[model samples]
Target: MNASMLSYILLSCVLLSVQAHNCQVREIIRNTKSLLNKTEESWSCRETAATPCSCLPIPEPGHELACFVEGTNHMMEHNMTTDNRLFLLNQSFQIQLDRNLCESLTSGKECKYKTKGTVKTFLEKILKTYQEIHKSRV
Candidate 1:
């Protein structure tokens, strides 16, 4: 194949790869949302005794899964209420799995809500961190 043809093919492959990745993320968001909705009715009671936000770790860059797992484990280890579990799941969604903990996803806002503790006051700081990672933090 000619060099131009090869370049185009490579570009197409890259695009497809990215689309596939996005599709996977979207599917996860869909599934998590569904699961949460299924049990949402009882969430209010769970929130009545919400876990302290301090216990939630702000996942570092490239540590989305690790942080998520750790957070879940933390919750389970302490037998956290269902609301806290769902809260993490929802907040994790705003970032969609690739940002810092305190960062906001849609607004491009930085550290939008590192404080304040209440379920309703969230969106103001709902696991919104979605960083693009311009460079290494190290």
Candidate 2:
């Protein structure tokens, strides 16, 4: 094959690879959002004493999921009476997750509660990878 033809083929391959990577990242984000919605629904309780409340799987761009909860008021001050004990339990759970994320330099804004940390790092990593692969396009 001619050198020019070979170069063209290589360039096309690189562009396709970058597109695939971005698609994968977007897919993950979608799945995570679905999971968050489920968590919020399950977590919302009319009575503070309700059992079996579900904990949401924290999204990597932590702030997005929290924003999702803003409308719901973090399940606080809703039809259900708020329980201090249950509130503390929820905060602790979020804090643990945030601590783990921060350890990896994946911190972002806090979640619905101030205790929750944003996981911007995970998304940032994907973005950085995308940028590297599509440097010419940017």
Candidate 3:
């Protein structure tokens, strides 16, 4: 191939890689939002003790998930109710899996098989974290 043609091909490859990275980040974010939203809805409905509960997303760059709870009276409670406790336990495990997936993506690894799994995991983490905090009332 001509030198010009080769250069064009290389440039195209580089551009594609950059695009893929951005796409991956975007996908993760989208998935995280969906998961958090669903979890927040479920937790809010199930938890009777906490009023005006919510999973407030923490804004951060890249593939990271963090959340805080709002509208819970901490002084009145010290532990999570039975339903909330069980939900958190399941969600925490899911979050750990998601964290691993995010780490892979951030570390320059490609998620060829299933990116959705990672996104789902991070969302669970956000939800679980929100519930756990409300449960602890701290």
Candidate 4:
């Protein structure tokens, strides 16, 4: 085989790898956005004057872009796929929730009371992590 032909093959491989990486990043961003939306919806449904539940507040605009960049960087750093990161985040949130609240809700009991503070804390941690990721990228 000619040296030129070998070089062309190598270049093609590199380009393909880059494209694959870009695709993975895009998928991660999409999945993260979907998860955030779902979380916000659930929080809105649970929010009330007495037992308020809320997720991290997104800024007016450009928030999604920031989150996408942050998430992509984090996934890359951790060598994790979109689905894996989402699952880990969900598991972490669940673990951080108040045990009593979880049990009450899961055991078919009248869970009238819940600690909004705890939920807020969990959301803050997640948001802060992303913010740090974004800042580092910047």
TM-score of each: 0.32, 0.22, 0.23, 0.25
Tell me each candidate's RMSD, in Å, in order.
10.5, 14.4, 15.7, 15.6
In model 1, how large is the Cα lDDT of residue 118?
A: 25
Candidate 4 has an lDDT of 0.39
Summing lDDT over every window of 10 consecutive residues in candidate 1, give the lowest-scoring window.
129-138
For each candidate, how many residue pairs have backbone atoms clashing (under 3 Å)?
Answer: 3, 2, 0, 0
In candidate 4, stretches whose alpha carbon ends up further than 4 angstroms from where it belongs are: 1-32, 40-85, 88-121
lDDT of 2 by residue, 3-61 (tens): 99999999988865663344333433343343333332233322235642222223434
In candidate 4, position 136 carries an lDDT of: 51
lDDT of the structure predicted as candidate 3: 0.36
Instruction: List runs of model 3 lying over 4 Å from the truth.
Output: 1-12, 19-23, 40-138
Q: Is 1 or 4 the stronger prediction by TM-score?
A: 1
Q: Please give the TM-score that candidate 3 achieves against the real structure.
A: 0.23
Clashing pairs in model 2, backbone N/Cα/C closer than 3 A: 46-80, 108-118
Candidate 1: where is the Cα deviation over 4 Å? 1-23, 31-54, 81-138
lDDT of each: 0.40, 0.37, 0.36, 0.39
Q: How do these models rank on lDDT, best leading? A: 1, 4, 2, 3
